[model samples]
Target: MDTHFIAFVLRALAVRLHTNRDFLSWYEHTKPDFILCTNFLGGSVIASIAKRANLKVPIFVYAADVFNNPKAGYCSKIDRLFIPTELGVKNLLSQGYTKEQVRLSPFPLQPSIQQMEKLSKSEARKLLGLEDCFTLLLNLGGEGIGSTALVKQLIKNKLAWQVVVVGNLSEASKQRFHALAKQLPGMSMHTPGFVSNIGHFMLACDVQAGKAGANALMESLSLGRPFLINELLHAARNTQTFFLEYQVGWVIRQPKQQMITLKAFAEDKTRQQRIEYNLKALPLQFDSDQFVNLLLNEVKSLAD
Candidate 1:
């Protein structure tokens, strides 16, 4: 069978499975008045099901991608689309979506991050058993992609700083970090994979170096720390722009230039203070219920 045909068949099977009798029965029993879908194609299927049932449910989509281009037919079924930033809104507008169709909302945040108590740098360092020195946090999300290479560069350059590596690190990466810590007494390194108190870790570090993920960027902003981007995923390009526009972070354009950039950033106290000043000037911390309230108001308006 042709690869595309096989993929089409599997997708059809999955959709059919999703709208099976049992699933339909459960969905009907729930009697949902409003629907919010995060997946583009999935939202289309859900909208069709609601239409078939003659339910007057309002369908909304929360898209995180910087460039979102759902088929016009699929978008027609959606009542409203929510995006996290103005850049996302611009992307949708350029794709021919009406301004009324796209509304900007705060990026959804983790519950732990929202409820986390603010910690002073000294307090956070004490809690994490980190030394009072220049600290760098290398986090590239749970998969730990592109992390080992950055760590290798940092080690090769021998920039003596407290380095903490987080996320789902492979055993090989852990061993490498351990070996380096032993070999170089001046360089401090700790790899605690998948920490629950990641907000604290972010607090304890001077700069966050990793992928330009929305969640990480938001957390770094709330914590008033500059994010150093080493890897730029295509999906997070807009997030990188956001950081640059706000002057709250630095970007390492080339992998080999990581050390030189870090060295410069470390030496530039004026730049550090400027970023901190900008962070303080911006409104970052919000009550956890803000997003929840936004949803409730939207749903209530539909009901009215």
Candidate 2:
């Protein structure tokens, strides 16, 4: 039988499994051999229910954060704890999690990013209605962190390049940038709101200026863009180190630093080319088939 994933609404799930009899009824109806949760709350709660009901089902959890957050008290109850990077493993180990319980796994990417067809930068820009100007992608991620002033600074100073600043799930943010796009004709500017095709945008842009985040970091690498991640977000250090060590990207904390880096990048084609070559050469192993097989193997092992 083909393996499929199921979602449980936490509120309804809690009420349904409030008693052992209720849990048994639910389990019998579903016949699940185990559970795998993406975050701490769901995993912790599920583990508790299984234990209380004397259910021997394995609980697997993929902690999304690069640094181990102490709130994930459910690690003790989990049969397997998957961490994304070696740095993550070190963090978890330092917190006294047993080596046997932890497994190194790839950072989970959205299906859209994983399945996106490779497109040339020009083709991507054309699709997005951008002109031939040097394209810069300004994303503050889904929650719209550090959106306002950073964008204004870029628009004011970056007169040479075309910048696409996305509001990313914030209407107020979208309106704010959209207003700037009208006013800043000197620098070709586009303000889009909460784009679903962000991976494509990453592909289209020559450079990325955003938070040092997992999705942004990975998407930039996946597309070979020069990532200009914020140095202040300490949670992203693991990926930052990997990129810096591999000579793929940089962390910039200030607007002045952004200009200095971009100026250097513009003048240094050899350096940029080298970084691109290194990026393409990295063993990403991001194929959908391979990831599906990996998940299936993990599930099968638990079943056995």
Best by lDDT: 1
User: What range of 10 consecutive residues in model 1 has the weakest lDDT sum?
Assistant: 66-75
* Tens-digit lDDT string for candidate 2 (119-144): 88888888888886677788777777
lDDT (0 to 1) per candidate: 0.72, 0.68
Winning candidate number (TM-score):
1
TM-score of 1: 0.84
Off by over 4 Å in 2: 1-29, 66-74, 155-158, 169-175, 178-185, 231-237
Clashing pairs in 2: none
Model 1, position 273: C-alpha lDDT score: 90
RMSD of each: 4.1, 6.6
Error of 2 at 100 (Å): 2.9
lDDT of 2 at 104: 71
